[model samples]
Target: MVSINDNFHCNGAYVAGDRTIKCWRYPRSHGSETFVQGVQNSCNPVFMAVAERLGADRFYDYMVKFGFTEKTGVDLNGEAVGIIHKKENIGPVELATMSFGQSFQITPLQLLRAASAVVNGGYLITPHFAVKTVDENGNTAKVFEYEKGEQVISEETSAIMRDILESVVSEGTGNKTYIPGYKIGGKTATSEKLPRRSGKYIASFMSFAPADEPQVMCLVLIDEPKGVYYGGTVAGPVMKELLSNILPYMGIERDAEGTEEIFTLMPDVNGMNLKDAEKILKQNGLDVQIRGQGETVYGQFPPADEKINAGTKAIIYIK
Candidate 1:
């Protein structure tokens, strides 16, 4: 969470009215963080300070340069162009909010395309549906092709960004989304609904595998989920689940070597009878412990669809 004191005087005030921007942080993290760590912790103050330094003109130029203001022109139907506030009206407050993904809105596809460019050596390749085609006799036809677009950022900038993004998965809020044997990099984001007073959120995570040379960029967004809504908690696992299957299927080898056990998604045992839930848990190689003397389960720790190490004890609460 940011207080008025967190403002850096490099350019602007950290004002969002009387409301404080509550941010979640790790317990072991010191009160202050570096720029890279800011990416890891998802600190609003750090980005705000950056936006303050960049000011409105440079920030708007970067955004427009990244294709935030125009349609991606992908060969897809119904593509929605993203929205950006006018440069003249973007004052300190507006700039601060926009820096951390508020005030202006971008479509997921747009963000994904831009992200792909960020990691794919700065070339924004148009996304297509097919990678390759096979004929009846197993002869491979040419896969879909897209025009190689212009470079939006420098290779050095992309490399630096990739390293920072990799740090996110290795040591930051995205740690849960890490795969054991692959180099993964990405960012996690949770945006509050417009007007900021509404308690609803849009949780999202964007990832690319084998960070040294990204092959694919995966984007996951969850809207208004129940219980916890942090991007790391909600959207991170969804990305992990997808890549866990996709990486292996695409013949991407695992690079992790150790005794680390494979993780599986926690099953939905809530509202099930105790007998049935226990049976299902056991079938999935999980040890179950009932927390109350009741026949019906009310909840389960680790929650449904979340990845947990195999054989971890699942605590099922009953009432």
Candidate 2:
């Protein structure tokens, strides 16, 4: 929760109506805490200050800049755009409340998009579970294309944020979500819903891999879970499970000289960029067949992060 508050809480005043924008300041380490450790301990006031320093308008701009206000128009059913109350819609106390994920609501997809942007080099992307769209003739087309959804910050800023999130799992409140071998980066958020009055928490965990240059990302949310209700303890494990089941399924290599000696079948590379995806295949002594002119990699025939048999043709499409 401290990590959430540290990243989300803020206070500020703007020209009231401008959409164009901008945005920490962290917890002191007086206790047995280190850099991110202070924040990971869920030190309320510290994270609140971080959010306060970021201010509300800039944070709200980030929300829009990251595609939270729009529906993303994905093919998935029952999609909902995150609803954030703007300046006029909220004030000092309200904004501070929002700093820790209060006074706001976002769907699973919306949250995933925002978190993905942070881990994906500050580029917001349309989240899609399906691989591609197929025509009646069986000719396939890419479903979503990556086109710089929005540049929310400099690459440096994203790198810093990624490190802080990684610290959350390595040594902070979210330590429970840490996975061995894979350099997992993530943040935890636990917020109390309004009007319920009975005190229920919404737990969420967002994560990615190769922290430096994330290849894939994920978000998990657990509603009204019993006993311990925190982003780390509750949502972190779910996030871990998703990766445990999905990463091996994706066929990502574990050896240092990956694909050097043997070639494996491709799993799924639905959200990867073409150049990056192609590199993996080329190094594996495999071939690629691209079907479209899309610049963003939308889907892979054999898929990604998975292992495969020798001499497999890995088909990938970009937007």
TM-score of each: 0.73, 0.63
Q: What lDDT score goes with residue 308 in model 1? A: 71
Which pairs, if any, clash in model 1? 1-23, 181-255, 181-256
Give per-model CA RMSD: 10.3, 15.5
Total backbone collisions for each predicted model: 3, 27
lDDT of each: 0.80, 0.67
For candidate 2, lDDT tens digit of each residue in 1-319?
1232233321222112232111111222233334365456554444445555667787677667877678976777877777778767666565656665667777777777778777777777776567678899988866756456667766876887788878878777777877665567887788776675577878888888767677778877788989887778898888878876776687754444434444455655677777777887777767778878866787777756576656777788888
Q: How close is candidate 1 to the true structure, as a TM-score?
A: 0.73
Residue 28 error for model 1, in Å? 12
Off by over 4 Å in 1: 1-30, 132-134, 256-319
Superposition TM-score, candidate 2 onto the true structure: 0.63
Residue-level lDDT of model 1, residues 70-92, one tens digit each, is: 88887789889878998898877
Cα-lDDT of candidate 1: 0.80
